[model samples]
Target: MLSVMSTRDEEIYRSCAGELTRYATGLVGPFDAPDVVTDAFLKASGSSRWDQVDNHRAYLYRTVLTVAMDHHRSSRARRAREQRAAVPAVAHQPEIDYEILDVVERLSVKQRAAVMLTYWSDLPADEVGRLMGVSEGTVKRHLDRARKRLKEWLS
Candidate 1:
């Protein structure tokens, strides 16, 4: 049976969807943005703590990020499995920028999320920490490591 969503839930979704989509886009790229947002909302709304949560927007943000990280992990595993099992094909492969991918791959998921939320979202470190469920110092450390790695790799 389909349970009706509460009016507050609908209101929250309407207000937050655009921002969440953009945030997800920054995390996982544009092509996967919509699915990330949808998955995040589903997980957030279905959680047992959903009703008691005072900050729904922040909760959803964390959920979206978690789902995006999971997506990355599964995607990496799938690619590895395919590469191991499949024979080399002569089909033309699309050109990819390995330099940028290498830079991205060097950072941990937390570091990437911290950088994206801080730089792309223009949010302060404390806010980014809150959204990411980390302390402000942890967020700063992640950013510092990310910047050092990027500078070293790009130079």
Candidate 2:
């Protein structure tokens, strides 16, 4: 369906896809993340969904989460098999801002989504409000609260 979309629709969907990919990548490994994101897009663009969306990006995100969770569940056996197959022991690399992602994780899903969609995805507040099914003022409050938490955590 996306393959046959008009230019404007394609552009909007592309933006959605790009963010979905990033979100999926965070949820899974980079090696398989693209496939996960694309699979979510495929599910999202299927016939049943094309006519029933208020915010397509948020719909795509929910799709990504569902797909990624399924992937993690089904792939666990394979992951364990590969883990025992003479694989190099990967050490945990330190993140400079693990504190921030940690603090962000402490937020409720809606609050975290609100912050990430606005600050990380670079969408406007009103647009994020639409995506997260909240008013603009509500989105602003969530973002402000998330930011304050992050600032206090990282300071």
Candidate 3:
């Protein structure tokens, strides 16, 4: 199916994959980010409207965001089920940077996306707002709340 993608589509994929993966990582975490990106690209490439998209980069970003949200929902449901089934017991935890992830995970999805796009991607507020389908002011609000939460958590 990938072989059927037009040269333009391939170009878009190549240029945007790394940034999209990073965005998805912030939304859904590193473990699921690549798969989220892959799924987004696959969906975009397979869409009947692929050739009609005027803004391929924006389309890809939106696709990645949607896929990441779906993954987050599914993961949350799975965790709930596992929690209900498993007996309470201590398990050896891996040494990793939980502090940052913990703070990020506490954010609402929109706030997290806003924070990641604004800071990590270095996108302008207007562009982040466009990608998130919100006004620039709303994006700023999300970022404000996210920053406040992160500050509280880190302190």
Candidate 4:
């Protein structure tokens, strides 16, 4: 069934699309960012309370975070399954800055989200907390822990 979005909702989506894509890209990566944004907008449009949202941007951010986290979890599970089936071999790996990606990937989902929202998206801790449905203090804690781990790992 086709669901129609109000003009206000359309406007909100248009205004927020680029920022949300950038935010989602930070969380998920470039390959999946567009899909994640699309999914978030679709969910927002489908919501019965779409017209009632006091903060459409915040609502959209939260939706994108949820969708990206779901994508991350599913991708991790798929990779785990693939790794289990892979044949063992001593192959030389190419040198690259994979350590950064590895460190980010090792973070708990909440910590990763907090770090991305804070540093990559340049969002304030309070806003990141609102987007992640946590308190500002919690967001700070996540960022603190993530920074310490990243520093230690990169050292």
- Go through the candidates in order and give each one's C-alpha lDDT: 0.83, 0.67, 0.83, 0.80
For candidate 4, give the lDDT of residue 125: 90
lDDT by residue (13-126, candidate 1, tens digit) is: 989998898787666655456788999998899888999999999999999989989987777676568557977656544455556556677787788889888987899999
Clashing residue pairs in candidate 1, if any?
none
Residue pairs of candidate 3 with colliding backbone atoms: none
lDDT at 98 for candidate 3?
A: 70
Q: How much is 128 displaced in model 1, in angstroms?
A: 1.1
For residues 1-155, write the lDDT of model 2, one tens digit per residue: 23565575567577777677666555554445677887877777774756668767777776776777688668777767865784543744333355444554556555656766776778898887766667999999987876776776657
Off by over 4 Å in 2: 1-16, 24-39, 51-100
Q: In model 3, where do residues sit more than 4 Å from their true spots?
A: 1-3, 77-96
Which TM-score value belongs to model 4? 0.76
Give all TM-scores, in the order shown.
0.76, 0.52, 0.79, 0.76
How would you encode candidate 3's per-residue C-alpha lDDT over 99-150 as one tens digit per residue? Answer: 7778788887788899888888889999998898789999999988887878
Candidate numbers, best lDDT first, in rank order: 1, 3, 4, 2
Worst 10 residues of 3 by lDDT: 88-97
TM-score, cand. 2: 0.52
Clash-forming residue pairs, model 2: none
Error of 1 at 66 (Å): 1.0
Which tens-of-lDDT digit does each residue in 1-155 have in candidate 4? 86567787788889999899878766776555788899999987788887788998999988898888888878877657755886644553334345556666667767878987888878899988999899999999998888787887758
Candidate 3 positional error at 61, Å: 0.9
**Greater-TM-score candidate between 2 and 4:** 4
